[model samples]
Target: MVREVITYPNPILRKKSKDVEVFDQKLHTLLDDMNDTMKQHGGVGLAAIQIGIDLNVLIINIPLDKEGSEDDGKQLDENLIEAINPVITHKDGELVFTEGCLSIPGFHAEVTRAENIIVEYFDRQGQKQTMEANDFLAIAWQHEMEHLSGHVFIENLSFLKRKKFEKEWKRYLKENSKK
Candidate 1:
């Protein structure tokens, strides 16, 4: 099932997600739904909170072609990463990447994140997994993990940039309301 993604200004997006203590059928279903939703929205990654669920879960599946690979631009299910209760165990260096969120549609901003990271998380089956990711993958982890902590990438912007974004966002909301 492709769940509706909760947008910005929704209180649920600000609510800190609770850790998944029970690895059961419900968790599995949520993960499945998230994958469907992410693909439907054409997002490289998604957090559980993005779908109005307050569980510490997120998935990342960058298209093979996006990494300059020879394969066609398709996101493979086998490459989908389900991170439950993820924690950034290590971070090194820094890089800036343009990021867009499903919640904040039509807005892309350059956000500085760790260039490399070691994340410790649990897979869909409750098995503990550790991933060492760099470049775009590392940025994805930092972005989605922030959602689990009730933070948004816009918060990382400079004061001036954030204020500008706020003005533009308010205008966008007004236009959207008319629709």
Candidate 2:
């Protein structure tokens, strides 16, 4: 089942997630739930913090958004997916993109990130794995990894940019409050 994502101003998002030591049933379930939640909400990625869990866990899948692909029965880009914990060992090639978060609704900011990276993580089955990603994959990994470190994408914004978003952020919070 998809879980409710905790929004910003929730203290859980501020605490760094604890590392996973035991690869067990609960870890497996959490990964499943995260994937379910992310797809349900049209999110590209999800972190344990978004689900109010404090663990070094996050999942990312960045499929290219091609028009009408979902409606035309076209096969999904398999390269666009896989679950990971994402420890960056090497990074190069920088780019900036405007990023938003599942945990911080209606807010986005430009964040500079490595365009390429080598990462180590576990697969869905808890098998230790490592991979190198460039371009979109690297950006997606960096974005999701920030959650495990108790950082939100908006934090990459300057104070002025954050201020610019404050009005819309408040409006989103207010609308969501009624739900």
Candidate 3:
């Protein structure tokens, strides 16, 4: 099931998500729905908070081609990664890239993030797992992590840029309201 994605300015998007304690069938369903929702929205990642759920869950599916050629000269397959209670245990270097969020609709901003990260998380089966990611995968992980922490990409923008984005977002909302 593709869930409705909560957009920017929604209070739920600003509220921190609660940690998932029981990894039951419901959690499995949420992860499945989140994957469907992410694909439906053409997003490489999605957080539970984006779908009005206050759980620390996120899914990522970064295409191999987007991982950058400079990333250890290795290619990854298109794998669905479901992370519950993900934590960034380590970060290395930094890179700035233009990023967009499903909740933010048609806005994009240059956001700086760790170029590489070691994340510890639980898979859908509730097994403990850890992986080292770099480049786009790293960015995607960090992006969804921010969502779980009640923040959007615009928060990383400069004050003037954020203001500009807020104005544009308001205009967009107003224009859409007429129809």
Descending-lDDT candidate ranking: 1, 3, 2
The whole-model lDDT of each prediction reads: 0.92, 0.78, 0.90
TM-score of each: 0.95, 0.85, 0.91
lDDT of 3 by residue, 54-90 (tens): 9999998775455334334332434778999999999
Model 1, span 18-92: residue lDDT tens: 999999999999999999999999898999999999999999997775455735548977778999999999999
* Top lDDT prediction, candidate number: 1
Q: lDDT tens string, model 2, 1-179?
A: 79999988788888888877777888888887888898788787788878998887887766544652333323244533444465889999999887878887666777899999988987666787888888766887888888889888877788888787777788888887799
Which residue pairs in model 3 clash with each other?
A: none
Cα lDDT of candidate 3 equals 0.90
Model 2 is weakest, by summed lDDT over 10 consecutive residues, at 68-77
Q: List runs of model 3 lying over 4 Å from the truth.
A: 65-78
Global CA lDDT computed for model 1: 0.92
Worst 10 residues of 3 by lDDT: 67-76
- For model 1, name the residue pairs that clash: none
Q: What value does the lDDT take at residue 22 in candidate 2?
A: 77
Better of 1 and 2 by lDDT: 1
**Predicted structure 2, TM vs. truth:** 0.85
